[model samples]
Target: MLSKSQIKVITRLKQKKYRVQDGLFVAEGLKVIKELLDSNLELHQLYTTVSFDGNLDREQRITEAELKKISFLTTPNKALALFKIPASKTIDSDQFVVALDSVRDPGNLGTIIRLCDWFGVKELICTTGTVDCYNPKVIQATMGSITRVNVSYLDLERYLKETRSPVFGAFMDGDIVYKTDLPTIGTLVLGNEANGISPEIEGLVTNRITIPRFGALQAAESLNVATATAILLSEFKRKG
Candidate 1:
């Protein structure tokens, strides 16, 4: 049974300020909560509607009706957990890493995080303006991979310059992604939703790349940031 104080705490977590203050974030769904337990992130509490065999510090199996009271998910998943957002470490230049340049939209950010985990890209460096890694929407979209990857919000430009690895940028009219040679190491800079790559970052880009478009079909400006990221990651991993 959830205490009145516990209810208050969970309700407060919906806001970013409280999350930051408590140094904890929410992850919903069986997959995410299970993966969170498996990952390095710490599980503060596990609220479930059913019995869970997975390792947990404190597990409360509430009713489906009770779950509706606490869960932020549209359909209360089997489990929901609160975890501490782990601070990401510095980039190891020798290994492949991704850097985000103010990529907004929590879902997009989450998708990118999942991509990083899938590609085995351990380090993700984000500009100061990028969305918070622990945002619920981003966490939701990341499926369960959020636990497997280390996401760091940092001065991307400074890191890029200091690391000076084979920094690559994705642009609309840039070189073909398939045709261009992509280095395994260095930062892959993904820009904001509408504004592609920022002028400041374009200067830092050692390699400019674009996903090849297909047959003549007058469509929207370009692919969504998440889709673009998936393609880019696939190509880089495929090549190197």
Candidate 2:
């Protein structure tokens, strides 16, 4: 059973201020919760509907209806966990890194996080206006990849200008990525879902690259941001 105070904490996490103040974020679903338990991230509390043996001993096995009451998910998950927001690591430009320029959708951001983890990319750079990585939707979409990826919010344009490494931006009119030369160590910039890359950072791109389009030319504008990221990252991996 959840106390009124605990319910308030769950509600408070929905707001950014509370999340920042507490330095904790919620991770939903049994799979995500399990991954968080195994990772170096600390588990503040565990809310679950089933029993399992893992790193946490301070878990509560609430009823399914109780989980629904507290869950931010559309369909309540079997578990919800309060995890310590791990300290952000310093940006390492010595290897392939992804820079997100205001990717707004939580699902798109989360899928990118998963891709970064899958591709062994350790660091993610997000512009200040990008979607909160800890947002419930992003957490759910990451599907446990959140535990492995390090997402840092930064002044993207300034960082791009300061770093000596090559910066690549994905745009429709850019050079074809499949035929272009990709560097082993640099930043890849993916821009906003609707607005595309901002003009300030547009000039920061050392190489403008685009994924080749094929098949039906239905007036579809472009691939979704996450799909574009997968395509770009896959091409980079091919170079390795």
lDDT of 2: 0.90
lDDT of 2 by residue, 70-182 (tens): 89988987988898888888877788899999999999999999999999999999999999999888988898888788899999988988899999999999999988999
Clashing residue pairs, backbone N/CA/C < 3 A, model 1: none
lDDT of 1 by residue, 73-154 (tens): 7888887788886765755668888888999899899989989988999988888789887878888989888777778877
Span of ten consecutive residues with least summed lDDT in model 1: 85-94
What is the overall TM-score of model 1 with all chains considered together?
0.92
Cα RMSD to native, each candidate? Answer: 1.8, 1.4
Off by over 4 Å in 2: 216-218
Q: How good is model 2 by TM-score?
A: 0.95
> Where does model 1 exceed 4 Å of error?
54-57
lDDT of 2 at 152: 94
